[model samples]
Target: MSVLSVFVPVLAASPAAVLVQATEPPAATPVQAPSTKTDKATDETPVIVVTARKSSVTNKIDRRVYDVAARPDAAFSSANDVLARIPSVTVDPRGRIALRGNSQVKVLVDGVEARPGVLNNLQASDIDHIEVMTNPSAQFSSDGSGGIINLVLKKKRKDGLNGIWSVRGDDDGRYSANANVSYKTGRWTANASVGVNRELTVTRTDGRQHWQTTSGLETTTGAGRSTTSPRSSYESASIAYDLSPKDRLQLSGNHYRPRALSKDAGTVLITDLSGVLDDHAESTVNPDRGEGGEITAHYTHTGAIKDEHFDLDITYGSSQSQESSTHRLSHTVPSQADQAYTYLNNGRDSSLTIKGDYERPFGTSRLTAGFQAEQNGSDARSRSENIAAIVPGEADIDTAFSYSRQNLAGYVTWQTPLGRWVVMPGLRIEADTWDAGAVKRNDLRFLPSLNMNRDLSDTTKLVASYSHRTQRPDVFQLNPRRIYWSRLYAYEGNPNLVSQDTDSYEIGYEFADKGFSSNGSLYYRVNKNPQTDTRRVTADQVVIQTVVNADQSRAAGLELTAKGKLMKKLDYSLNLNLFDSEVAGMVGGETLRRQNVTYSGNAIIDYKPRPKDWIQLTLSGEGRGVALQGYKTGYYRLDMTYRHKLTAKWTASVRAFDLLNTSKQTDIFVTPEGDSRTVSRKERPAIMIGIARSFGNTGQ
Candidate 1:
C-alpha cells in the first residue's frame, strides 16, 4: 500500500510543482492518526515514488492517482464513473478501457490478474486507487498490447471494528446493497464482505442505411427500434485472515440470478412505400438464473535481500447458467391451446493455478522471474423439451460433454535506468495442452517486449516501445453451443477458431507543467487471425451471428490529450483518438474500408463561489468513426451539481444529466436484404436530482 498525492478539491488546477509520483530520496509525508476501530488496521504507505520508463529511484512517474473512498448508500454502476477523470486513461462505450486507444490491455486487482478469464465487475467504492501504468516493465503480464490498469482495494486492520453499507435503485427497476468490515487484535487480522444486486438494463438502436444483396441489387433504408434487456441479480461473500506480516489466506464465492426475459417488437416501413409495412414481432422468456463461485489461497514472503520477494498462490472457480424459453407472438396471450417449449443449458468449469515469482533489485536495475502451472476443466449436461399445441407428445433430448486444458509458463524480465533514459525488456513462453474426450490439441507461444523512455526535461518526456504478443481464444468464445441473448439475436461459438497473434509498435511524447499538460501517441498494431465478427448483418427470419476468425488485420491510431487549470475557478481536460481498422475476407474479397474512431475524453469544472455553496459542470461525448462514412454520430451532455452544507453535519445535493433537454443519439444498427428487410435501434434523454445529510463528524 503506497500513495503520492496532495488534494485540495479542484475548482481549477493548482500551479504546484508537485509530482504525481514521488522519488524515494525525497522527504516523505508526515504520519497520520491511527485507527480507533477493530477489523481495520494501520499500515505503512510509500510516500516516495520513482518515475521514468524503468524508473530510477530519482525519476518521476507520468501517471496520476485519484482517491475514491466509500460513503453510505453509494453504488458503483459502471466502468464509466470509475476510470474516467483519472490521468492518462479512458474507457470507450463498449466497455473497452485503454490508455490512448488500445484494447489489448491488462486489468488487475490487488496486483493479481482478477480472474483472467472473467469480465470486469469491480465497483468504484471498492476501489482504493486506479494505477494507470501507461508504460510497464517486463515484470508485468505481456498479453494484449495496451497499458495496464490495476485497481487496488482498501486494507484490513487489527483493532476494534467499523464498516460501510450502501443501497441503490436503477431506472430499470433494479436494486442492490453491499457491506464490508474488518477487525484485528495484537497479531491477527480478519475481514469480510457481502453484496446483493438485481437490475434490468434495456438497449434500443435505430439507423438508416443502404445495402446491396447477394444478387447485387441495391435498396434504400428504413429505421426501427429493437429492445434487449439483461435482467439479472448477483450475490457474493468473501472473508480473509492474515497469518503473518507476509502470509495471508482468503476465500470468496458469488452467484448471478437473472430473469431470462426479453421481447422484440418493431415496424420497418419504407419512407415512400405504398402499403408496404415490414413488421417483425417476437418474444423469448429464457428461464433466467446463473450460479458461480471461487475459492483461492495464497502466501507471500519478503526475503532479507534489499528488494527480493516470493509469492505462491492457488485458485479454484466454477460458474453455470440454465435457460428455458418458449417463443411467443408479440402482444398475444394464447387462450385455448398453447404449446410450452423448454430449453435448458448449464456451464460448469474449474481452474487450479499454482504460480510463483521472485524479484531482486540491484543498483539502478531490477530483475524478476516467474512461473505458472495451471489446469482448467469443464463438465456440462443439458436437456430440451418440446410439446405440441393440441394432442401433444413430449419431445426430449439429453446430452453431456467435458473439456480440459493444462498450461505451463515461464517468464524473465529486466528493468534499468541510465541517466534520464529508462529501458525494460522481457520475454514469456507458454505451452498449453487441451483434451476433449476423443480429441487433443497443443499450442505454444512466445511473447517479447522492449520499451524506452527519456525525460526531455523535468516537464517534458518522450517514449517508444515494441511488443510481440499472443491471444488465445477464450473458452466461452470456443464453445460450440448456441448462446441466446434474445429471440432475434443468437450467438454460435466456433470451437475450431484459431488464436490471434499480434506485434505492436508505438511512439509518444508528453509535456507537463504547473499550468498545462499535453500528451500524444501514435501506434500500429498488426494481427494474424484477428477475432472480430461482422459489425452489422441483416436477415428476414432471425439475426444469426456465427463467431468466426478473420485473416490478417491492421489497426493504427493516434491520440492527443490536454488538461490543466483554465483559471482559479475553472479546469479543462480533452482527449481525442483516431484509429483505423482493416479486415480481410469481410464482405468477400477487397479489404473492408472504414473510418477511424475518435473516442471521448471528458472535462469538468467545479466552482465553490462561497464556503457553503458549490457547483460542478461536466461535458462528455463520444463519436465512432465507421466505414460507412457519415455513419458516426455524437452528443454533448451537460451535468450540473449544486451542494450546500446547511449546517455542520447536514448537507444537500442535486445533479442533472442532459440539463438542456437536447436530444442525444446513443447507437445505430442497420442491415438490408433485397427481398425483405430488418432493423434494430435505441435512444435516450434524461434528468436527475438527489439530496442527503450526515449526523456524525465524518472526515472532511
Candidate 2:
C-alpha cells in the first residue's frame, strides 16, 4: 500500500496551516487546510476556508475494510465491540458473532487462523483494521461457507523503542490488563506482548416442555440460575530480520492458558393428566481448564518488478483441555432416594500447515498462484458414572476415540482489464482424506470463482461476483460418542456427516463523494447437504440432540450501508439487512420444511464536544432467526462510551453495555412428539472504566 499527501489552500479558520495525508485512499480523502499569508503592501492576511472529510468503511474488490481507529470508542473497546458496529455483522450479549445470519464463520488475526478465546482477549487498540470478505477469491481457504472476518494488528516501524500499557475493570467483577512493546535497531525488529483477563457472568434460565403420554398430556417445567467465571493469560513474541533490501525472514510464537468454573441450582417438576408425578431439586458444578500454543515462520522475497513477490509460511499449533461435572438430585414431592452423577471428559488436538504463494505483474494485468497443505489430529475420552439409592437399571458410559484429517489444495487467478471493466477469474482444486475410528472418507473437489468491476463515474462503481465454497464438519461435530448433560438429556455427534457446499452470487453498487459514502448489494446462495441439529426422544424419555445433513437450502438477502458526517461535530453510520431463507430436511424419520423472513440493523453516532474529548452511542438489533426445528426470538441492545485525551501520552475512557437491559433471548422448538421453550437473561448490565499510557513516540 502507498500513502498519498495533498496540499490545497482554503479560507483561514484557526490561523494555522495544516498538511493532511491520506493513509488508506480513495475512501479517506485529504482535508484541505487553510493557508494564510500577509500582503507586504497592505499587511492584510487573506482568508481561506476548507472542510474535513473521512470515512471508516472502505470498499474493495473482494472485501470491505473497517478502520478501527476511525471509531470514537475504539480506544477502550474490545474486538467484539468493534465487530458489532460493522455492516452485516451481529454480536449477541453473550459475545457470539454471526455474519449475514450464519454462525459458522471463520475468524483470523494478522492473516493467521485464531485460536478459541483469542478474540475475547484482544483489545481494539491493538487492531489497525478489520476485513470482511463475503465472497473471497481462490487464494483464500474454503472452510467457512458463510464468509470470513480478519483482524489486522498494528505494527510499529519507528526507529526507536515504543510501548503501550492499559488496564480495565468492570462493575461485575471482571478485569483485564495488557502491555505491548516493540524495538527496532539496524536491520532487526522485535516485538513482545502480554495480556491477562478474568470474566464473570451470571444468568437465569426458564424452560417448559409439553408431550403426549400413554395416559394423557404430560408437562415439565424447570427454572435455574447459574454463574460462570473464566480466567485466562497469554504471552507472545516475534522477531523479523531483513536479510537484504528485498528479502525478509520472520518468526513468532504464542502461548495461552484458560480456566473456567460454573455452578447451577435448579428444580424440575413432572406432571401428567392426574397431578404431579415426580419433583426434584438439582445442583451441579462444572470446572474446565485448557492450554494452547502456536509457532510460525515466514519468508518473503521481492522481485525486481513491481507487484511481484514470493512468500512461504509454516505454522504448527497444539492444544489440550479437560473438564468435569458433578450433579446431585434430591427428591421433593414424593420423598424418594437421592441420586448423584459424575462426568469426566478430556480432549487434545494438534495441527500443522504449510503454504506458499507467488504473484507477478503480467503486462497491464496481474497473475497470482498459491498452494497449501494441512494435517490435523484430535483425541477425546469421556466417562460417566451414576449412583442412585432407589433408581435402578441406570447404565454407565466410557468411550474413547481419535480422528485425523489431511488436506492439499492449489489455486491460480488472473486479472485483466476488458473495455471499461476489470475481470478476475480463478480456479481451485482440493483433495481431502479423513479417518475417525470406523469411519473413513475421501473427497476431491474443483471450485471456480469470478469477479468483475466497472467504473460508472469518478465516484460510482458496479461490482458482480460468483464463487463456490465448502465447509467440512469439525472434530466435535463428527465424534460418535455421546455426552450426557442431565439424566434426561444427552448430545451425540454424527460420524457419517458429509461436507456442505454452497454456490453464492452477488451484485453491488458503491458511491462516494465529499464526506459521505454508501454501498448496497444483492446476494443469493444455494446449499447442498447443509448441516443442522435434530432432536429425538427415546422410549426411556431421554432427549438426544445430534447433527444431520439437510436435503436443500436457499438464502437471498439485500444489504444497505451509509456513512457520513451529519454535521461538523457529528458523524454517523447506518446499516440494514433484509433476507429470506428456506430449508427442507428429514428429522426423526419425518420430512420437514422451514422458511422465514428476517431483518437486522445497527446505527452508530459520534459527537465531539471538545477537540480532545468525544462520545459515541451504538444501537443494534436483529429479527427472529429461523432454524431447522424452530426459531429464536430477536433482541436489541444499547451501548455508550466516553473518551478524553488527558495528554499526548495519556487517555481515559468509560463505557456501559446493555443500557436498556434488553439482552434476553428466547428459543422455541416444536416437533410432532413434543414442544419446548427456553428463555435466558443476563443478571445485570456491565460498566467499565479504563486508562492507557503510551511512550517513545507511539501514535495514539
Candidate 3:
C-alpha cells in the first residue's frame, strides 16, 4: 500500500479499530499480467515552488542590521525618512539626528567616514542596508561617544547591464528625480548615478522671555515668520577591475552642489513693570551656497588560507560654503533712527584619509588588525558692518581663522570560540595633534572593547558587550571668533575646550523562529567632561551662547524590537525604548543639575491585498528630553504609503508625510534670574506621488 493510503485509513478509523488493525497482519494482493505491445505516451506536468521572504531586520551579537531593499517605500524615501523609522534613532525638523537622546553619534558610508550633510543628499534606494552598533569594537574609530551608524551601498555583481529611473513631486512645491545605470563584462564593472532635489519650506516662531532687573521685572515677546528655498544636485561614478582570481581594485568619485535663499520678518515688544518700553520691527534676508567633492581608491588581496584577506583604501575630500545676510531694525514706538546691518562669511575645508586592514584565521580562532591616518584643515573669513553705527565699536569688524588636525590610530582584535560561547577582545591606540591659530595641543589615548555571545538553542542566543569611546571638539567648537546673529545675540566658540570620553555596556537576548524574531537589550553609559552649550548675558546686556565642558552625565536605557507576520497577507515590525538621563554642570558660577525619564518608539504595519499591491503605515514619536539648563517637548509623526506594480517593469507609489500635522518643537529654559520659552513649527501635511521604471536585469 502507498504511504498516503495507509495513513489516511488510520487517521479516519476509530481508536479501537485502529488499535486492533495495528497488531494484526494484512493479506497480500494478487499481481496483474504484463502489458502488451505499445502503451500510449503521457504528457508531463510542471511543478512550482514557493519560498519565504527574508526578514526586514536582523539582530547580531554586536549590532542590528536593517534591510532597506526589503521595504516597499525605499524607492520613494529619503535617508532621513528611513532613519526616523529605526529604533533609537530620531531626526528633527532641521535634519539633525540623535541616537538614544545623544547627539554625539558618528555616521559612515560603506565603512568610510562621510562628509557633513551627505545624508541629506542621499536617497534610500542607493543603500542596501544600515548597521547600528551601540558598543562598537576597537577596530572602528572612537570619534562618536554614543555609537556608530554605517550605511552599506548596493553592489551589482551579476554580468550584463542594469538601470533605474524615477521621478517624484509633492503638492508643497517640492520635486526630485534620480537615475542610475550599471554595466558588467568580463572582469570589469562600472556604475553611475545622478539626482536632483528642490524644496520650498515655510516656518513660524514665537518666543517669550522674563528677567529680574535692578528696578523691576523686564519682559520681551517676539513673533517671526520665515521662508526658505533650497536646491541640491549630486553625481557619482565608480569602476572596479579584477587583476587575478585573488586580487581586485576599485576607484570611485562623487560631487554635490547645494544653494538656498531665505527671508524673515518679525516684531518685538519690550516692557518693564510699569508699561511698554519700546516696540521694534525687524527684517532680514540671506543667500547661501556650497559645493563639495570626494574621490577614493581601494585595493584588496585574498590569501590561500581560509578567511584570510588584506585591504587598503585612500580617500581625499574638499568643500566650500559662502553666505551673506542683510538686516534692518526700527523702533516704531519711539520713532527713533533706523538701524541697518550687513554680514558676509565664507569657509573652506579639506580632509585626507589612508587605511589598511588584514585578517587571518588559525584553526578555530580569527585575528584582525588595522591602521588609519587622517589629516584635516579648514579656513574661514567673516566681515560685519553696522551702517547705522548702532553698536559703536562693533561697527565694522573683520576676522580670519584657520584650524588643522592630524590623527594616527592602530587596532587589533582576536575572536575565539569555546564550547557554545564566542568571545572577542580588542584594543586601539590613538595619537592626535591639533592646531588653531594661537592654540595648540597634543594627546594620546588607549581604547578597549569586549564582546561575548552564547548560544542557548537552535533559535535563541545571549550577547553582551563593553566599549570605551571618545568625542573630539570640532572646528566650529574650537574657533574663538564671535559670530553675530543680531544686535542682541551672538555666538562664540571656546579655544580651551577638551574632548569627551564615555564608557558603555550592554546585554541583550535574541530569538528567531521560522517567521518571527525579537530582541531586547539593556544598556548603561557614563560620560566624563561632556560638552554642552551655555548662555550668558554680557556687560552690554547682549546674550552670548558658547560651548563648555560639563562635569559628568549618566544614561541608562532598555530597548526592545519584534517583527513577524500576523497572517498570510499581513506583517508588522515594532520598536520601543525607555531611558533615564542625568546631567550636572556649572554655568556662570552656578551649579546646575537635571534629570528626567523619557521614551521613544516606532511601529510599521504592512498589508498586501494582492500580489502586485502593498500598503504600509508608520507611526513614530518621542518623549520629553532634558538639556543642561533647559528641556525640550516631544512630538509624534504619522506616515502612510501605497504602492502598486503596473507591469513587470513599471511601478507607482503615493506617500503622505506628517498626516496628523503634529510635528512641532518647544524649548523651555529656566534660570535663577530669568526664564524663556520658544516654539517652532515647519511645514504641514504633504502628499507625494512617484513613478519608477526598471530596465535590464536587477539580479534579484
Winning model by lDDT: 2
What would the C-alpha RMSD of candidate 3 be, to one decimal place? 7.7
lDDT, candidate 2, 477-561, per-residue tens = 9998777776667789999999999999999999987688899989998889999887777655567788899998888999998
TM-score of 1: 0.75
Separately for all candidates shown, the number of backbone clashes (residues 3 or more apart, or on different chains) is 24, 5, 0
Q: Write the per-residue lDDT of candidate 1 for residues 348-410, one digit (tens) a residue.
A: 777777778888888778788998888888876656555232112423546666789888888
Question: How well does model 1 score by local distance difference test?
Answer: 0.55
Model 3 regions more than 4 Å off: 1-55, 387-395
Kindly report which residue pairs in candidate 2 clash with one another.
10-48, 10-49, 11-48, 11-49, 12-48
TM-score of each: 0.75, 0.93, 0.91
Q: lDDT, candidate 2, residue 649?
A: 87
lDDT of 3 by residue, 456-499 (tens): 89889999999998889999999887766666568889989988
